[model samples]
Each structure stands twice: as structure tokens, then as C-alpha cells.
Target: MLKFTQNKTPKLNFKKALKKPIPVKCVQIDEPFEVETMEGVMKGKAGDWLMIGVNDEKYVCDASIFKKTYELMK
Candidate 1:
């Protein structure tokens, strides 16, 4: 038998990009819906976010994740 657990911090040399900001389109949904993405068709719940990326890729993101991961482009 073998047992292992993840209790180590990442040691990979990852750095944030210092590139130009490219804005995308984002909208909030008022009802459950589905959208086509590069990955495939995905379902979203009310209050989720629909994001259209730089290359016109469309996808849905949960409201909580959208809030934590993105900001309004003002």
C-alpha cells in the first residue's frame, strides 16, 4: 500500500506577465443558460457571467469566480 498527501508549497518559477492589458466583454445573466466555448457547451446559472475573450471565445463563469478573477474595465 502507498499513501501520499499534498502538503508542500509550489516551487515552480511562475511569474506574472507584464504585457499590455486586453479587455474582454462580460455580462451577467438573469436566468440559467448555456453558452458555447472552445471546450464545449457549458451551463450557467443566474447571476453567472458570460465572458467573450479576445479571440471571440465565449464561456461562462460563476459569479463568485468572476468577482475574484476579474474587474470592470473602466
Candidate 2:
């Protein structure tokens, strides 16, 4: 008798939307934003995304929300 082994597909991890940081002209806060840093809650606006440091720490917010709120920094 011959036996066949079942193939299993790898599971996907969606815990984090953005695994790495991308370049953004800046984060325009139409209203206001409060971001938490390793040190504590740091705030600011304008400049590169990675440099913005808003996403440096773990966050559960959807970036698309910001995309809808803010246009390309240009």
C-alpha cells in the first residue's frame, strides 16, 4: 500500500501592516496627532516618514486612514 502526504500552505502574518518603513514627504496633521516613542509621546509634522518616527514603535492604527486624510507631501 502506498501512502500520500498532505501538503500544507504557509500561514500569513497580518499582525503588522507595514513590515518596513517607507519614504513619505511628510505627515500633514489636518487636526492633530499624538505618537508614542520609546522615550515617550513625541509629536511633530512634516519631513520624511522614517524620520517622522511616528511609526518607529508598534501601532495598531491604519496608515490608509492617514493617506485619505493627507495628500502627497509634494
Candidate 3:
């Protein structure tokens, strides 16, 4: 015979969670962005963000999207 167990953890409120201020780091894009050669596709600026390539290739993205993504990464 076997016994069964149940989880009683409460569900988190995501909407309320987002209300808190998130801490992030400030970084500058030092070079021209290449879209094709990037890995770990993180968020971008405006519409595009930035990515660090597996082979040391860096890219720049739109401002809005990058801000959003940068916050998440922070």
C-alpha cells in the first residue's frame, strides 16, 4: 500500500507583484548591433534590445524593449 500527499501552498498574485519597483543595472551599448549573430536573445531598446553572442558578438536593440528587458534581467 502507498500514501498520497497534497500541496497546500497559496497561489501568488502576479499583477500585485509587478506593482513593486524592480532594481536594475545601467549598461551602455558600445558598438553597432548585428541582428543575425546573437545568443540568449534578451530584450531590446524601444523595439529591440541587446544580446551577447556565444562567439562574443554583441547587438543593440530598440529602446523601449531594451528597458523592459533590462528591468527583468536586473
Candidate 4:
């Protein structure tokens, strides 16, 4: 029989957000960035999940969701 286990380790794609993400003054990212994780659906700005604020809020999210959700800022 084959067995499947949850990946406890963070993957490469999970490095989208840094522990200490820098805040940009006038960076406009897309909206409605959402990702389904083991916990639940995570929501944030399209290209700035690690964003500490909406023009300024201190929130936390896993890198996995951040990578999957963040869009490219133009």
C-alpha cells in the first residue's frame, strides 16, 4: 500500500513573502488575491500578500499561500 503524508517542510514557491517584507509607499497591486490552504482560504492583495498594511495593517500568512496568491505588480 502507498501512503501519503502532509508536507511539513516549506517548498520553494513558499518563499514569496519574506519574514520582514518591505513596504512601498505607492505600490498598487491587484485585488482579491486568495488561496486555499490546509487552514482555509487566505485573502490579501494580489501582489503583496506579505503587505503589512493597506496603504498601511499588520497581518500574517504562510508563504505557500502568499506565492500562490500574489500577482505581478506593474
TM-scores of the models, in the order given: 0.73, 0.25, 0.26, 0.28
Once fitted onto the true fold, the runs of candidate 4 whose alpha carbons sit more than 4 angstroms away are 1-50
- Which 10-residue window in model 4 sums to the lowest lDDT? 20-29
Error of 4 at 17 (Å): 25
Candidates 2 and 3: which is better by lDDT? 3
Q: List the residue pairs that clash in candidate 1.
A: none
What's the residue-level lDDT of 44 in candidate 1? 99
Provide the RMSD of all predictions against the true structure, rounded to 1 decimal. 4.6, 13.7, 10.5, 12.3
Q: Which regions of candidate 3 deviate over 4 angstroms? A: 1-26, 29-51, 72-74
TM-score pick, better of 1 and 2: 1
Highest TM-score model number: 1
Residue 25 of model 4 has an lDDT of: 30
**Candidate 3 vs. true structure, TM-score:** 0.26
Please, what are the lDDT tens digits per residue for candidate 2 over residues 24-73?
34443444456665667755443313234345552222356555544553
Candidate 2 global CA lDDT score: 0.45
- On the 0 to 100 scale, the lDDT of residue 70 in model 4 is 57
Clashes of each: 0, 0, 17, 4
Candidate 2: the clashing residue pairs are none
As a whole number from 0 to 100, the lDDT of residue 10 in candidate 4 is: 39
lDDT of 4: 0.50
